[model samples]
Target chain A: MVKPETLHAVLNAKTVSVVGASSNPDKTGYQVLKNILDAGYQGRIYPINLKAESILDINCYPSLLDVPEDLDLVVIVVPAAAVPEVMQQAADKNARGAVIISGGFREIGNVELENEVMGIANAHDIAVIGPNCQGINYTPNKLCACWPLLTKRGGMAVIAQSGTIGATMGGWAEDEEIGFSALLALGNKSGVGEIELLDYFASDEETKVIALNIEGVKDGRAFIKTAKSALSKKPVVVLKPGRTRKGAEAAQSHTKSIAGSDKVFEAVCKQTGLIRAEGICEFYDYSKILSMLDAPLGRRMLVITSSGGSGILAADTAEDLGIELKQLSTDIKDRLKEILPNQCVVSNPLDLTGDATANRYMQALDVAITSEVIDCILVIFGDPVHKASDVVRDISSRTDKPIVVAFLGGGDVEKEEVLLMHQAGIPAFPTPERAVRAIGALLKKKNY
Target chain B: MHKLIGKALADEYHLNEAEAWELFSDYGIPTPQHQLARSVEEALDAAKRIGYPVVMKIVSRNILHKSDAGGVEVNIMDDEGLSEAYHAIIENVLAYKSDAVIDGILVCEMLKGGLECIIGMTQDASFGPTLMFGLGGIFVEVLEDVSFRVLPLSKEDALSMIYEIKASSLLQGARGQVARDVDAMAELMLKVAIMIEDNPEIKELDINPCFVFEAGGGIMPVDARVML
Candidate 1:
């Protein structure tokens, strides 16, 4: 477990000092300070540089001790050997937390130097994020401590092993309109890693879902325990790469040969209730749905599509992913038949026909919400249906039942309406398979 | 620590097949009734006590792959057959590994009419002790249809491992076959979990071809191996 005070100081620090802050835009130190300024952080920003008197129009100090006020957090971007001295300076200045963005530590086999930095932080009881990480983003406070600045704010908190992947998730949030609460790029992980971050984000009120893109865990047992604890409060979606890697080399038994790290990681996910995403798209798609909608009452999905082909695609994907598509009972089928056209099918997919209008969607959605059998609904716009976004917005606001939309093949209409659906807090996918995959992510929560 | 494991650890060698079976019995993991026979007379007596249709395999620390070395003989239904099997195993083992130290033969009741499954444990670098389960033989060798759960496993975790494999449907009486004793398999898994947790000295364990019988018939481990 992470110390509450440490997490609080790192995430909600009011006064932050950037050690090794530079004047050149090409340097990482300068860009970090610029990102902090551009994020419109309400807190005071202190830039420390030995060579320059000022950076980016802000007065710069020669050392952390030269700072006028007490520092709550320190962002260090100095060389690996300089990090220990900066940490010592941070300790003397009574900084509560530090984010070390420099990368020459343990990653490059500089173990002794990294340990020396850790020793300083530990001795001072100061919480440290990394000695070799990209940095962090706490959107609620408009703090973009890392590079490749992203300020769009919403609900999901992302923690990734690679900074590029973290930025990619942020990019997705910016494009999809479903933003993030926080993002932490854990490089080398010499200090705080996934376990501590998971413990912190699970209780974060602003965070509705936690997304993790990790290569491996340091301690599997500790991870399992922390993940289980987090799952009790909010959903955690994880994408663990290297599923094809073989087991350890010193295998003596058949069990050891097959109990590869990937297989064990899968088991850990299953036991801890972590939603395991297969790819980057699924990771974001899962998080998007989790951050937006509540878990449906059950797995029974009622897919309302304008085309049979789209409906079939949904059924196929849902089947592959273990999302149930039960046949509609005769009573509900008859009710749907009365409102639906005679040519429309009264099945689980409930093909509304490619020519079906937006009004037909509302009718089917109405029957789905009232029906005790239908736990969730998937709406597909197969053509340029008029008022499709309006139908989705009106229908979603009217019910608590989970709803996902696939606004594909509607040309410019879909391109516009999909954005509207996202703004309405309704998960909308560009394809039917992706929409069904999103629904599958929501259904995974109930089993654990 | 179990004396067998302590000895294996001190000697810096894996436990023989018979010793492995004994260690499994000590942990309450079900094993077939049997006894180590040092002589032809002892082999006959052991076969009579364990009943007809017995399995005889060479027990030697030097020879880990008994079947591959032609050190195993099965279905000895009479005293004559048991005696011949006991001698043949010794002869075949010597031919496979000339300097192998023969530790007598393991004569045990032969299992019949059950699904072959494997349940074992190995120390994982990150996860520590992890238990694995899957269909035995070709399924585990070729298809790699296995599932793992890190110890100490809960009832739910153990049960989930049993159903997580690709061939899990076969345990549920797929087609017209009677459902195998999944509860028994789950129970055995829990026992193995506890065993592995209590004995960290156990570096690796294998119970290949564990016979899982009909719904109420229970499961029995036919062969076992332990590396300390």
Candidate 2:
């Protein structure tokens, strides 16, 4: 077992070498080399290419052995057929780490390629990342070795088995304006899998929420044991594909691995307190919420919404997700009734109607935040009087309790409101269902 | 000394089908309705009165594994089959337990259709009584799809045990088969829990092939044995 601190050091290495470095910007080798340089890593950059003299104005060596000094890390962005020789040279040169960023190995569903890659890496005692991968990114170290261009930074760390999924998640995070601590695309997982990555993230100070997109796990018992220990320190969210029989078969073909019975996985999840998401959207939704907001102290939920339709939807989604919509105390209910119209329901949802101003929204939030009956508040605001971002800013200034927001309508208001809410440490979703479901996830994480 | 061993542990060891069934009934476990006969003539008469086709097994004080010794016969559709099966069972008993007293034959009404499942209880030294549920019949050994819960189990605990087994989907209507009576299965588990709660001397009990029918038909304990 690799130590978490050692893995962190490897991820945050200052100096790195680009093996098979190319001057062609269109190729993956060139793009990754460019990303590493663009991230402004203050370290020596050694470009190792047999044919090239220089790449992007950085001097290129014929091989790692030809380099003048020791390298902290080596990134392999070459063809699959040439990987073994490059890895051998890297090992002989005593490179501290190697990231294999190429395809056509095990993930291509060929046993011959898998065995050959494994034999070479094992013989050299090299801890390789992937033969079919987009590589990895570490925000704190300003290290970016992955190809598909990511720039945002935050507290959520993503560890995905699929390279495409990891890159897509990074892209999604950037598009949603959510920052990431790290993005690791572990393709084929010839050397490292979720078990090692999870143990690595367990002690990583920068990672507040660890999200996993798993296809098939190697060791069920070991994974469960490691996950159980890690989950106590930080929340671990999993979006597992290959749940159905056909999907499991497809996953086996995809990674050359077997997906065990979903029932066993469910039992393990229950025992080890791993939060499982249904799909990609829920995965991002839950991860974003968990990254931004604190875990709910309890399951008691209070909904303060201006739109009656949105309020009803939130309440229904809450019940479906097993979140208890507790009744407010008489004092709290009376206070709400006195401020609201006669038609407004002064119950669990505490509908304030569409006529609510920013002050009214803050007052309702204040009541829910102070009440002994409510554990968390889900505030859904209708079309705002001014900009939706202003309402979000006011709400954040008013409440200390974990607040999740759902903006009702579409426009610049929705986008600006979500961004503002996130900036103020409140997670905002596009729909009431997502907001309620996120609250459910937070409650589960706290209890587990 | 052997007699002393039997006498000292008489209340703590072994029950034939009828005795086990009565004990289970006392604890609210359901079993099929039937009677016992002391002879082949009486067995035939009991089958005639109880209606055919029926199941018959040799009842002897010293013989416990009647099926293994060829003392059990099923689906005796007529008097000829019944008479032949009875004499064969008697001959089997005479050969296996020559010194033991013959305690008649048990004639039971045949239980039909539905999935076969087994519910068992064994008292572990550390865990106390651990209840188990699994697919019954010949393939049971090969397919060890079983789940266990430490007793005494609540209804929720019993349901969780059933859900724990991978083959539980088969019981819950997999591939167009009607879902077995899960409510009845839960009730059966509750009954087993109560039985173990009441009889601390029972060290082990096996109710193999607890025939579970479709919804509304209920479940029946076709065969059972107990060891104290």
Candidate 3:
């Protein structure tokens, strides 16, 4: 029953308005208006401010009613108490959606004011994003309604409960050049909640994978149903903080005495086909790996390493994660032996020693990718190797199988190899354990 | 089934063992054949009818843990042993709790030893009814070796929940022991799922030490504590 405004109008509004538009470049109002212009939004902009004749060289209106035409979206950056009036005005002017970037409201326990704004938005059929939010974006549409800092468009969509965390994740994606299709922040959640947004992004062509940072859910059953439907077409990675005792202390289960637990959430994810990330870092790690490749058919992983220790560590982590490490048969071993040195161990963690070169890594990768048994490949490199970047190139072009790499140890050589893989659209981690985790996210046998 | 549970909870916070067994039986769960006896004479007669050697335990609404308070007596070989044990149970329970109200003694045929497993239901405020399955016995929770899934469970979910526990190997016959009946256990789980699905007011259900016999022997719910 709580359907949001057509996401098309909210994300790709042709006629936008910025109420309480600021002339000061340092203010949030100014940043929001500037970001829209900077993101190249090819739409009409109206600055609703009585004090300014123009903002960012765009003509300004005294109020929403003063505008000559209906608006598709409105970004409100006024004080909290002033939001309901602006919302009422936007509704009167037939604005389809309002992205309120103001603070106060339910976030500070001001439920009365939040309710008044929600009532106004609902009555006028105005879909509000926030009263206190970090704002939102749709990079493909060049609609950056969020902060001025922006990244290009990609297939991953980040929906986080904490605006700060969402911004940090967006920044990391920008830094790593991992583009995002959409970045939606949930402010006090007095407006549209996560479930409504999930339904919108589930079918969004630009969003191939959806990542969520949730503190808690208001409606468990509805959330599960929404997530379950979304999961059929794309991967939904969730990160819910506060499960430990310390985490529990911050939250009180207002329901029953048995208490709410992360275990039940974990079990729900297990049943609903959603992926649960243990930490913030793992959320992006999963997104990076998932964005790079499709889901593997089976959990059978093949580890190809130049160092024995890294290989063993990967095997152990893979086993702990319940991923089956396919033991290379003698026939496959013989094929590898033809290219690797005599001292190389032709086993499951098919290690080609410390002195092994990129040729050996590629030979093993080539054989594994060609094997009918292997479902995915995990390549590890430590110490010196010949053209580590070449291994990434061969894997990226030669095979359709999902590939993840671990460039172990440090130094410019190792760092360069990791960056090279990222540039080639391959997910590479710094440690063997991390690489194994990345593979586990995509290659696990039983998923929701 | 709800009426039975309601009547049991009419004046008490919990159900007596016999009433709980009735609810389990209504859901297709098997229980040992037994009858309640109000006196030593009735206890001896019920024992004879049920076919001794039998188990005679105090059936009191106040006595939550029967065995702990020396309220249970087993292996009644004859009328004399039955009479002696019946009086001893009453005396011991009254001594344990001076104000305790003794209902009667439940006389039943002794069950053979089998694979001990446990099944339970706890209503999480957020998730509603959740079912738990693991190695059965009183200390099941202390071991903390259990897996849970929100109900109503499908046949597939029920089967997986059974083996998802670490103690599942014991159910399949560990250390030369006879392999217990797994299908019977899965069936029991589904039936329990149905029972809870019909009633949401049920706060917790404790059916510990469910005995799963050798293949084809079926299963039995030995003890239960149904709370509202």
lDDT of 1 by residue, B114-145 (tens): 89999878777677888999998888999999
Better of 1 and 3 by TM-score: 1
State how far residue B202 of model 2 sits from its true place (Å): 25
- Model 3 in CAPRI terms: which quality? acceptable
Candidate scoring better on TM-score of 2 and 3: 3
Task: Give the per-residue lDDT of model 1 (tens digit) for A260-377.
Answer: 4777777788888899998889999999999998888788888899889999999999889878888877888889988888999888888889789888888888787777777888
Which residues of candidate 2, in runs, are more than 4 Å off?
Answer: A1-6, A109-113, A341-345, A385-400, B1-228
The number of clashing residue pairs in each candidate reads: 0, 1, 2
For candidate 3, write residues A1-448 as lDDT tens digits: 3454466678878989998889998788889889989889888899888889999999999999999999999999999889888888898888888888898776667889989999988887788787678888888888888884785777789997778778877777776667788888877666677898888888888887889887777777787789878887788888887778767555433111123567777778777878888887888888777777776788888888888989889989988998888777778778888877789888888888888778777777877777877777888888756479878787769887778888876477776777677778888887888888877877632333
Give the Cα error of residue A88 in candidate 1, in Å: 1.3
TM-score of 1: 0.93
Give the better candidate number (2 or 3) by lDDT: 3
Q: Rate the local accuracy (lDDT) of all candidates.
A: 0.86, 0.78, 0.81
Evaluated with DockQ, which candidate comes out highest?
3
lDDT of 2 by residue, A218-261 (tens): 76657767887889888899988888989888987887766666
